[model samples]
Target: MRIIKNLLSACCLILVMNSCVKSINDDLSFVDAASAPDKLSVMFDITQDNTGLVTITPNGEGAVLYDVYYGDATTTPVSLTAGMKTTHVYAEGLYNVKVVGHAVNGKKTELIQKLTVSFRAPENLVVTWAIDAVNNFKVNLSATALYETAFKVFWGDVPNEPGQPFLEGQNVNHVYASVGAYTLRVVAYSGGAATTTYTTTVNIVDPVLIPITFESATVNYAFTNFGGATATKIPNPQINGINTSANVGRMVKNGPEVWAGALLTVGGNIDFSANKVFRMKVFSPRVGARVLLKVENLTNGGIFFEKEVTSTVANAWEDMAFDFRNINTGNTYSKVVIICDLGTTGDGSANFTWLFDDIRLTNQMPVGFLTLPVTFDMANVNYEVTDFGGTVSVPATDPTNGANNVKMTTKTGGAQTWAGSTIGAGFTSPIAFTATRTQMSIRVYSPAAGLRVRLKVEDRTNNARSVETEAMTQAANTWETLVFDFATPSNGTASMNLAWTYDMASVFFDFGNNGTGSVFYWDDVTFLTTNVIPNYLTLPLDFQSTTYPYPFVNFGGATATVVNNPNPSGINTSTKVGRIVKGAPEVWAGSFIDLVNPINFTVLRTFKVKVHSPRVGAKLLLKVENTTNPGQFFEKEVTTTVANAWEELTFDYSTIPFGFYSRVVLIFDLGTAGDGTANFTYYFDDISLN
Candidate 1:
């Protein structure tokens, strides 16, 4: 009894402890009833078509709740329930079906299933021959597929063997060594399953031989310096054996006379019944000269057919053919004579040098052929602002180069302006426009003689100034068109302005410049849609002096430092050192430090640089000094920037400057700014000359 009472007590204690532990655990891991759900099951039906409709059914016990993922976007959560089918029109592709179920005890389980929605195989595979050559050929295969299915092609010469098939719309090139009949097959496949096969046969034949003939009889010709002298037969002159040798007549260049001559017998007793039209090969120097082939019917002694052919370039042989079916054969004589005649001589210059070969008669009918014609299109028209003293004239004229050409100008000094000044009399307006195209083009014409014009185009959308200019020369009273292609900016807006100017004074006709007979004309400016952009700029050296206080430094080892002052005063001030260079080592040396990665800036069509020089007529040096290779420097002489005041120096960067140059430069030799004095200073700022 005592043992039983003790066991019961122990059991009660264990039971109470177990109950307490269960209560504590349940309280700690309790989940909200609304937040967590019980057993979840998902059953869905999906069509193998493009309409990705999925009907799902969820079945479970306690508080059954479910979350579903159609495998499209996880960010957007989708709640699913039992017996609720959702139709999702998704693109045809493989998708993962995800279902999540949770219990009130904070326990959850996820089940993922893969579903494939595929497109049906395309019906009616069509195959066509793109290129049909004698031995080699190409075929284009095409077919339609179900909206959801991706397709591929299988092709081979055999009907059903394992062969290479390309994707739909692929061109397949096939070559056969020997000419024979071959079968071409195409099979369409969806997913990994073959859907249908298309087969066809192509018959290839050997090259055919055709006979050629001439219409003239035996002829003789003299020699000359012009072209080689050779005799040719005229209308309906049948030469024997065209297929065996591919040649029928004899051609000679060396002769006794200064000019070559030929004679043919038109008398009877010749059978000309085996031939139709005439054909011959002539060899002559291609110095833009002309040669003639003449034929006379034997029925009549008069010449009835003749043809002239021109030669291009030099030292080339060309084939000449003529038809005599339309010739008027007079009654009586039944024979014909032929002659090869070189055109009239130029003042009896020298011996005619001409060679003739391969004269044959053929009965084949001529075939017709066609060629593609060249075509052009235009788009994107815009206007540029011109600063003509706020004048709204028919065409505003630019005063700097003063050819009275119209240009768009901004109130800001040194701002870009556009004008049609190089072209004859045009209108100007301040209407700016942007092009949807990636590229822009324009055509201009010059109407004056001995005058050349330049067209300038400026991009308004780019914060960095960029311009493109093209120069064209024109004959007197002749209209010529010029084209400018500007790369589209990344912003997708391509805005531009056009202008014309006559910068060269040596040319006779200056449209905008001061000249009595100089006039230029322009028209047909246009922009086109393209995907090409300007090649990225390449900077040899970029002097982004982040490490040093001063970006550029100048210190000549032994050269005189006439001026030594480092204060940004907007101009080269006196007290900076000046070096007098004479014979050897003729350079005022300077150094610049680069502190950052190279930055590429475009060379605008037109930009000006300001330089302060001390001396006149002395060469100043502007060089792209590379820190890596100090010896490699691009130097340009500063010719006309020598003035006490700041002188605006302009440079045209259409052509690259000479010398090995980096993006950063060390400038020296201020001879043109001021005389080499003890306190000579050169100031440079607003380096717009790109």
Candidate 2:
């Protein structure tokens, strides 16, 4: 009976197990038709403190678990249940976070959403800008900031300009249309919505070019130094003479290598077509210091040309010239290298330091003699005016008119009564003072009226042969032309002698009075017969006057005077011809004879003159203008067919109306300013109307 009961219990247990299995199978069948996860998404909670901390919380319907991808370069994905979040630290950037949702039916659902791991606002944002060394109009911009990923720049050159995006330490370039001051704005952005902005005023200008005056505030004079040499732009230590500028370039050559120096980018390839010489004002510590100026290709130092000059004046400023006439013009040069005392090493002392300014290139080489019409405006002319007795003279701008350049002469206190300045070292030629042309005029701006100014001309070879004259200033602080008549000698001075070769001139301001710190400005040193039209000149001007002043007004680097005929044969043979030397470094060099009375053009419309030229095919322009109105002018050009011989040139004025012209102008070789040579000398005489 016990065996039978156990068997029945086992059978009941088996039946109950079969019923449980059938219920499980029915549940599994229902799960097979269930859908995958729906509406899968993620939410990011970023930290506010620039820490780039993000809390990723994923959500989905019918999803039991999720695989969260941080979107960055993470090797493994994070697994999280529903309603659970994971913390991640990311750099400030944009990211597309991915979520893989797993449902109860073993189905997977994946979705990608943009994730932004933004931090707080950027802090301590710094922006820097620099002018491009090669292109003056171009600027390089960069920025740095804490907790910043990228930057946007507003160049402020256009209206409604869009921002340019760049990363940190990346150089953003901008080109300006012109030179001016512009507002530059840079925005530093964190990965989040926070941003930091910095604004600054940037000055745009032309890059440092041929004439590197070291005066531009916008130029990046960041010289590239090598071999332990240091170079910088500094305030001028000694400002006097021709260079009165405020800034200069200083070079300290206390380096280990003898060839230590600095190089500067001169913006572009140096134009060697026009100028071939480089000039600079240098203040050296001692005499005989060699200064080497070299030009090289912008990238290759091996392709270079150099010139060296030695300083003559110790502890004083002097203009030095470096000749680069043999430079290879075919090669391009964009850098200037300066090495002082090139063969010796510096000790970082005053002896090793040099100050320089007014670096420029020119075609005018020093001729060693300052010539007539000293305007002080010519490049590389070397108006080396010497001062004595505590008088200082320098090139200065006109006080009344800023555009007009003049010379400033200062007589400091405790100066000699005869404190004066020489006009220059000496003139290339002597002052030819004829019987009638014995006067010289100077435009003077005095500190006070009634100041006596003395003009003296002497033979440079012999100082004893000098004539001095005095003229009183009639205006104060205004420019007035004062005539000094050497014919009437100053008191206690020798009279003018026509036989002496007066090749040097000197000027004394506030004559006969001890300097009380008086200052004077003077310009336009002119030599003339007279400014007063004492008598009207008529036609048939033979220019043979020993008593009557021809009064030929010269202009544009011309020196015209009446003298003995140089070539007195062939077609004309006469003394006291009009000589014109067009060698004063100008192109439109000529002279005009201003007549007080108009020429008789009604009777004769044709004019003739005898001319002597140095070259054939030389252009001679003869023009006539209204006596008072220079604008009303008529001109005719003639060419010379005979070289170094006398010839008659005819000018017909048939179209020129009567009573309209009183000035007769003459120009030889009207376009070329020749070097000081005999080839530029010309002569003419026997002007008559037919």
Candidate 3:
């Protein structure tokens, strides 16, 4: 019993000590649920200058962090730790700044501070502006001054346009809508109430056209670039030789495509009918740089034509010509695309750059003016004639030759005595007439022989400066060339004056007689290079004398002319030769020259002629005929052995007896008609008896 009481006393002592330790570890701090962060405020430190810079510092009694909200719509609230400050730029306005402070226990306090941001008047404000170099419609503006915070622009192109805001040292661009001058206004604002406004004038213009010299202030010269090609109108860097304009077009290539180019809308279709050759003055960095000029339809890129040419000189201005004689005129091409250094990628270096000016259209020949030798066979010529005194002239098929085209003229019964038809709407240029060239010829088919055909020439601008001459038609209903000598004018008409500029010509059929429903066909109006009287043709015919008129009577689509030898080597190096172009009309097309007298065939029966043919195995016929009777003729045919070179062809007439034959007739490829191409052209010289 005594031992049990002792154990109980020991356990009771351990329990009392454990209870005392638990009482020492219990919480005794006070708790309040309504307590939160307090004393939240913000300080706004505004700079004294007009620049609306405001520095805000938020503070609170129990705050650990702060959120500052700028009243401007441009920015959101920013979070900052305690004792940190934030700066904000604002225009001159009254704004309410909000501040929120947060405690360590996540309870927040909010405050709204009414801050009045005012600024002084901006001083010495200057606005700098200029037109964009490549784009004339765009204007770039900038400003600099003291106490300026922001800038707003009034482009002056629209009514009630809200100003666009921009900061200092920043350039702003405004593109005008049209091509004219307009007022530009720029306003500079600061932190204070005052502001500075400046105004200037801006001008925009239209795009340039062909013959692009790039010197006009009103021309836009806007080039649309593709594949990294860039172009600008700039002052001429190297102006000499063919191009001396004040400004030029500069092209730089930095593209991956081989055909990178600059295209420009020309606003209208390029008339390729009269002027088929294009010319430009170019200053290339290197020689042999291929430059391509192309034209495309206004909206369709698939309809395009291009021509390429290489520069022959480097670092100097050179004139280049591109022949587009065969371009299709049916398509409408309005855009001009230029590519420099074609077929190669550019590196944006000076070596790949090109300067060009004076983009224009020239003529390979005088295609714009209608001069002599009007055949009515050219594809692009207008050939439109003007009729007077109730006369009408129209293009028609040749009555005798089907392959030839001529003009058919009709005079009504009630027509005037001077009824006539004019050749083209008064020639664009003056007719070439010299002292030795005072005669003109026309092939005419009249209703009756011995009809007086009058040919007159005058200055279209002045009717008093004119000369008229008359020639009689010899054959009726058959083609015959009549020579009109202007040196001997008609009895009452003016004489030929070489000093005047005669640009128009007209022909009158059955002159001095009132029209009685007469119809005539005429063609081949040629201005004779020499007088009407020619030297009579004879044997041993060599076309070397400039004074002798080698008039070969062409018939059945055969044309013969005395020209310089195209290829003057190989057996014949003579300066002059005869060229014959056979066209499509008859299979037996040929030419005959009337000799002054008959040939003496007593000893020499073989005839030899040096001929140059385009192909081998071409049949050449040489025949001798009576001057008046073509039935009494003897002929022999020979074949050529060589091509594009001179060779001697021989014909024997030993079987023919002596006769009065005074005409020499020659025919090439008698059975096959020709198409008047180079392949069907023949050249011959040195005709003699061997």
Candidate 4:
């Protein structure tokens, strides 16, 4: 009875297990059928010929080998070397190449790849020549043909015949006994039987002497002595008078002739159709003079036009130009003459002497037609705040509440605020503006005491990143005009930004502390651009004030100093130092100095140091290390002299392989002993790169 009960329980457990297996099979049946197949991967690299070799790898459990077809009807056995690459040279065409992978379990997979093949023709051939007058004349040939090919050259005095065949990429050097004319023919044959030929002419002539002259005949002036034909006249005389004794031209007695006949030209063929102008150089005169330049058409023998010019003492030896466009040439005459005179004897004293040189006929017009001075009027200063949609706020009343002329007001609190006004949200309120410049000027004004105003000037593009700012404090109510230089930022976008913030403590005005006070005004601003060259950095003697890390030691004769700072850090105070005497030691760590850009490294080709010590082992070391990763450094040692006088120590680091380094350290290591003074001192300046 017990065995029969156990058999009944086992049958019940088996039935439950079978029911669970059937439920799993039903759930798997819901999966997509397309996703249940084995995957085959095919990969290949494309070559210049447009065809590529492919490799196939199959991955599927419980699978067998079968036949494989590569989409082009080419079939092979499934057994292929693993990881082996094969080549397939297919004709030029686009194809959807596929590899069919099959298993003995009847399961199959296929991989498709889009393949393309292209065929290109050879490129054009090139020929170069090197003519040798003394020996053989060599002609170098090169071609862009991809395959092995033959070439032929036809050589003769006549260019239209075929000659002999030569191999491509060969240099043909032939000698000619005499100078004559020759023609060269080059032909190339490719693998496809396509051919191309090019021809050129070469001429060999005897060398001749070519004379180049630096003459000034292009201008209208011939020499004519004021004293007589025998008087020695300077080429361009500033003041002309008869020296009689020395035969030299001089400005004596009356004023000299500012317009000498030597500075005038006549009887020249002028072609107006080619667009020509008059150009001459003149020397400064002692007395100012008005000279008239008259142009006469020799064909018509009539004065066509005249131009009057005033010469001041400042008119030195500089080029003067006059255009013929506005001049009436009287129907484009073939011959023209120019005359210079003292303009009908008005204040014609002999103190005026003008020299002239370099007369040229040019087609260019004179530049700088007018010199207009830019001026600013402060009375018309106005501004408005407008949104992108062109909506403008009300004309902000001047002296609003207690503040005079709300130059700049902001609603945002904290950094952006206006005193005595209810602060609003968002960027808005009183805008600042500068008057347009007709001439350059500077405007200055004294503001209220304890009041600070921020002034900002930006370029025209409204690119605020380039805006320059200055803070002005009010000390008095006086107005002063300060000259402002506008040469550096000459892009002409110069606009103004004014903002004022007052502390809530006390209201201070001109001599009084009141709620309402007098307003501060500015006027007469001057703008000018000067051409002033800055002084180069020189070595200074105060070594302790330098920012560089130093234990700086001097062996008796050596001396050191700091210089000025330069833009781009060229030779400046921070860079230049002086060292005196021999055997003086100075060392700087590479980590403390700023490494210049990689491009600047090429400019700094060599390291130079000055040494006065006469020691044999005086040396300077320029060491550069990679800061990104430590332990990588390059050091160059320069040897110095032990002479009593100052001597330069140089190290040629032209071959130093430096790329993308972060740190550069320089050290001056003195030898253990030296002459003159064991304590040496040296002067060093211009730590320059290029």
lDDT of 1 by residue, 455-487 (tens): 333323332333333233423343333333332
Q: Quantify all predictions' global Cα lDDT against the true fold.
A: 0.39, 0.82, 0.80, 0.38
The per-candidate count of clashes, in order, stands at 105, 1, 5, 65
Off by over 4 Å in 1: 1-63, 67-119, 130-144, 147-155, 158-162, 206-324, 327-690
* Reference-based TM-score of each model: 0.24, 0.32, 0.32, 0.21
lDDT digits (tens) for residues 1-690 of candidate 4:
332343345445545666877454334232223232354555655454322344444333322332234455455534332233345655555766655444322345565767655443334576666565343333344434443266766666544656666665656655544556677776765533346667787654432111101132222123333321111134333323211121122222122443333222233335555344566554545435444444555456465655555554453444555555456545544332222334322133433444444445655534221111212223422222211111112222233233333322222112112222111111222122223221133233344433333222333223342322222232344443322221112112232222331111101112112223234433222223442211111111223332223233332333333433212132233444444334323233111242211212433666554444434555666565564654766677776655444455665767766454435444555334323254433344434333
Model 3: lDDT to the true structure: 0.80
lDDT of 4: 0.38
TM-score, candidate number 3: 0.32
Looking at model 3, residue 88 earns an lDDT score of 93
Report the poorest 10 consecutive residues by lDDT, candidate 4: 502-511
Q: How much does candidate 1 score in TM-score? A: 0.24
Model 3 lDDT-worst window of ten: 25-34
Best by lDDT: 2
lDDT of 4 at 378: 30
- Tens digit per residue, CA lDDT, model 3, 543-650: 875534676899889899899999999889999999899998898898888654456565578899999999999989999997666788999999999999999999
Worst 10 residues of 2 by lDDT: 529-538
